[model samples]
Target: MRIYKVGGAVRDRLLGKPVTDIDWVVVGATTEEMLAKGFRPVGADFPVFLHPNSGEEYALARTERKSGRGYGGFTFHASPEVTLEEDLIRRDLTINAMAEDDQQNLTDPYHGQRDLEARLLRHVSPAFAEDPLRVLRVARFAARYAALGFTVAPETLELMRQLSESGELEALTPERSWKEISRALMENQPQVFIEVLRACGALKVLMPEVDALFGVPQPPAHHPEIDTGVHTLSVLQQAALHKQPLTVRWACLLHDLGKGLTPEQEWPQHIAHEFKGLKLIKAVNERFKAPRDCQELAMLVGEYHTHGHRALELKPSTLLELLQSFDVYRRPQRFEEFIAACEMDARGREGLEQRSYPQADYLRGAATAARTIAVQPLLEKGFKGPELGEAIKRERLKALKAYKENA
Candidate 1:
């Protein structure tokens, strides 16, 4: 059996990136031979094993045939007869189909090296259309490598569009779709992932709520970009540029879903859109099975992002209520995420990206001032039960009033 380093390990290495994990493909090897050599069997669908010492994944070279629909409907064939070329050809991207030997020699039958040099993300073969997940995967790769100037080849994009048109993209399971989405959100250019998906028509299938935002108009006075969809993308880009956490990024993406539901008569004005967006955010969260933290933050951002922008003008009582609503006393970090998300929203407008967002600091100070109202002090004053809670609220309101006045 000949062992070769394959897939992402080889691809990242050639890009001068730090390779975190290495995958191996064993050519001319059988399951019996692998087991005889102390490799522990791991895969159920195919002959994948864990090397006894290195503990890295090593799979017997295998070829797959499409037997059904979706990504999981493939039947795999593995044996000594499966050539390395056949194994490589099954990969989704040419840049990921190359292999390396122990002596560091390259085995690039698919011209993956040439594609990598050209900064292209091309498909390995037409079989790319068989697995719908590759469409999301390629978009994710575009997000990951966008700063490096890598783009999907036009023919590959056409194949992705075909997959979308074929309805196979809808066949992707929620968990699988979220896996790609969450990873893409954390990439350097997460907005590019959204753009790519939109270009390939996958966005409309996977996230119709988001897709509907494209032509929806917003008040130009508040959003110079006018298009709610463009503003959303800009907000997402700002989140990534600021290195905000995943929860913040996700909140930015869904903050304006309500705008898409505005009545035609209300074209540029979406009164109460903040609260209107709550259900849409919940729907998206339920669809993706998003993390509780992400969903909660998105919901809060959707319901109260405008409140953040109005912080400076809001009554002290309103500021206290906003702080309490966010549970800032116990979950301050999530409140901070809320501020960051709202800042992204305000900054996402055209000609406003570099403008300062004083609302963030205003809310932060209000939170700090409210937090300073000690419960122990209320208890020390012999306030009890409802009276104590009421006293604490009163004290917090007083502190926030003074804080806002000082600002």
Candidate 2:
């Protein structure tokens, strides 16, 4: 059995990046042979083993054939005849196709080394068209490499366009699509994915609702770009620049999707946009097979347009009431995530300097006071069970009304 380092480990090493996961390609190694050598077989669909000592993945050299369409419809071949070069050739991008031997000798038959030197994400072969998932993969890679200033090769971009136009991307499973988009969202510059998706027409299939936001008009005073789509993209870029969390970044991308469908009559008059946006955000999350908590966080961000210190004016009772109403304990950290998401959305909007809002310090103080008051043991004061619940409800409502009247 011959072991060679493969994939991201080699790529990252070449780029002077920290390598975390090490993948190995084993040449001429059968499953029985691997098991005899104390390697544990792990993969079911194909031959893959875990190294006995290092515990790193060691997948047998394999070749693939397109059985139908999209990502999962594939047949794999792993035998003595399958060369390492053949396996690398089937990969989506050159940057990921290079491999290294135990002696640190690089094997790049596809000129991946040259592409790396040129700072380009080039496809390994024309066979990239066989897998529609490559389109999303390349887009995500572009997002990851954007800070490194790498551009996708023209031919690769053209292939992506062809796959998008042919509706091949539609054949991808929702789970696979979500995986790539989620990874892209995790990147520091997800606008690269947005830009690439727009260019290739893939955005239409993955998120038509978001695509509808494109060119949808917004008021001039608030959004100088004149379109909610452009404004949303700008906000997303801002969130990325701030290196926010995945949920916050996703919220920024989707915070204004509902504005496209809202009836626009005048300036600062998109009434119920937040409520409408909440519904649309939930729908999008469901469509993408997101977890229930993720959907809730998205809804929270969409519903609460104001964030950070502004949330402090909401009154402790009102904030607690909202939290308890949503069963926030079911997803312990969701409320904090929602708050972060809302803050990112608020900060992303353009022309924030001209808006009349409370000072950041005031907002922070209000929020802190609200949290303290809400968390206090009001029920412990000679109250029990149903009575305690009723008392808390009445007190919460009273607090909300008082806050509203004072404001």
Candidate 3:
């Protein structure tokens, strides 16, 4: 059997990047031979093993035939007869199909090195259309390498569009779809992920609520970009530009789903859109089964981002109510994420990206002032049970009132 480093480890190494994960392909190897050599079986669908000492994944060279639909419908064939070239051809991208030997020699039968130098993301073969998940995977790779000037080959994009149009995207499990989405959101250029998905038509199938935002108008006096879809992507870009966490990024992506529901006659005006967006956001949250922290934060931001933008003008009571709605006292970090999402919204407008968002500071100051109200002092004054709770609330409001006046 011959072993060679393959896939991402080889790709990233050529790009002068730090490789964190390594995968190996064992050519001319059988399951019996692997087991005889102390390799532990791991892969359920194929002969993938964990090297006994290095503990890294070493998959037997295998070929696949499409037997059904979605990403899980493939039948794999593995044996000594499966050539390394055959296994490499099944990869999603040419840039990921190269391999490296122990002596650091390269085995690049697919011209992956040439594509790397050209800054291209091309498919390994037409078989790329068989697996629906490759659409998301390619979109994610586009997001990851966007800053490096990589663009998907036009043919690859056409294939992605065909795959999306085939309705295979809808066949994917929610958990699988969300895994790609969350990872793409955390990439250096999260907005590119959205743009690539939209370009390939996958966005419309996987996230129709988001897809409907395109061509929708917003009040141009505030949004020079004019399109709600453009604004949403810009907001997502801002979240990534500043390295905001996934909760903030998720909120930014869906903050304006309600705008898509506005009547055309009401075009530029989306009165009460904030409240209208809550149900759509909840649907998305339920669909993906997003983590509780991500779900709760996205919901709070979607419903109250308007409040965050208008913090300076809100009454002290309104500010206190907003803080309470976010459970600021119990979960201050989530509140901060809400503020960050609001800031992303404000700066996401065209030509307004560099503008300062005082509302963020204003809300943060109000939260700080209200949260510092001490309940122990009220308890010492003999307030009891529900009365003590009411007294604490009153004190928090008083503190916020004072803070507003000072500002």
Candidate 4:
């Protein structure tokens, strides 16, 4: 049996990028031989074995045939007879189809190295359309390599458009789709992922709520970008630029979903978009099965991000209510994430990208001020039981009022 380091490891190495994971494809290897070598089988539908010592995966060189729909609807043939060329051609992108042998020999059967040099994400063959997951995968690669000037080949994008139109995207499980989306959000340029999906029509199928935001108008004075969709993408870019966490990025992307539902008569003014956005956020959160933290932050940002923007102007009672709503005392980290998402929203506008968002520090100080209100003073005054809870609330409100005035 001959093994070659394949896929991303080879692709990244060729691009002068850091390789984090390495995969091996074994040629002229049978399942029995792998089992005899003490390699444990892990693949359910194909011959994939973990090395006896290193625990690294080594999948048998195999070719796939389209037999069904979605990511799992495929038949695999792996045997001693399957050629490395046959296996490589079944890959999603040309850059990912190259392999490296043990002797350091390079195999570029499908001209993957050529596409890599050209800075293009080209599909290896027409078979790419057979798998709907390739659309997200290609978009993610675009997100990863966008800094290096990599873009999806027009022909490959056409195939993605075909997959989007084929209803195959609907066949993908929510868990699988969310995995791709969440990973893309953390990439170097997450907004490119959204743009690519939208360009290829996949965004409409996968995330209609986000898709609807693109053409909708917004007040140019508040959002210099003017388009709600563009603003949403800008927010995502800001989140990535600041190296924000997944929860903050997810919240930034979703904070403006309500603006897409604004009536044409309303044009640029969404007086209560925050309230309207909560329903869409709930549907999106439920649909993707986003983590509890992500869902809660997205909803909170959607419903109260305007309050975040107007922190300096809000009354002390409103500020205290906002802090209480976030449960900042119990879950301070989530509150910090909320603040980051709001700052992204504020700075996402055109020409205001570098604008300062002092509201974050102001709100943080308010939380600290409220938390510092000593319970000892209230207890010393004989405040106890349910009355103590009310007394603490009174103290926090008074402290917040003082903090607001002092600021």
**Lowest lDDT 10-residue stretch of candidate 4:** 215-224
TM-score quality measure for candidate 1: 0.97
Which wins on lDDT, candidate 2 or candidate 3? 3
- Runs in model 3 deviating more than 4 A are none
Question: Per-residue alpha-carbon lDDT of model 4 for 90-208, expressed as tens digits?
Answer: 99998999888988799989999999889999999999999999999999999999999999999999999999999999999889989999999999899999999999999998889
Ranking by TM-score: 4, 3, 1, 2
Clashes within 3 Å, all models in order? 0, 1, 0, 1
Q: Between prediction 1 and prediction 2, which has the larger lDDT? A: 1
lDDT of each: 0.94, 0.75, 0.93, 0.93
Better of 1 and 4 by TM-score: 4
Compose the digit string of candidate 1's lDDT tens values, residues 78-192.
9999999999999999999999999989999999999999999999999999999999999999999999999999999999999999988877788998999999999989999
TM-score, one value per model: 0.97, 0.86, 0.98, 0.98
lDDT string for model 3 (1-407, tens) is 99999999999999999999999999998899999999999999998999999999999999999998898999999999999999999999999999999998999999999999999999999999999999999999999999999999999999999999998888888899899999999999988998999999999988889999999999999999999999999999999999999988998999999999999999999999988988999999998888888899888888899898888999989988898898889989989899999999999999999999999889889989998998888889999999998999899989998999999
Point out where model 1 deviates above 4 Å.
Answer: none
What TM value does model 3 have? 0.98
Instruction: Tell me which of candidates 1 and 3 scores higher on lDDT.
Output: 1
Query: Candidate 2: where are CA atoms >4 Å away?
Result: 263-269, 306-333, 350-364, 371-387, 393-407
Rank candidates by lDDT, best first: 1, 4, 3, 2
Tens digits of lDDT, candidate 2, 1-407: 67789889999999999999988898877878889999998998899988899888899999998898778888999986688998888888888998999899999888887888899999988889989988888998899988888988998899999898987887888798888888888887788888888888888878887887887776676566677776777777777776777777777788777776766454335666777777678778988887665565677767765534355556656555555644544544665565555555555566662344343334333333333345247655767878877876666556545555654
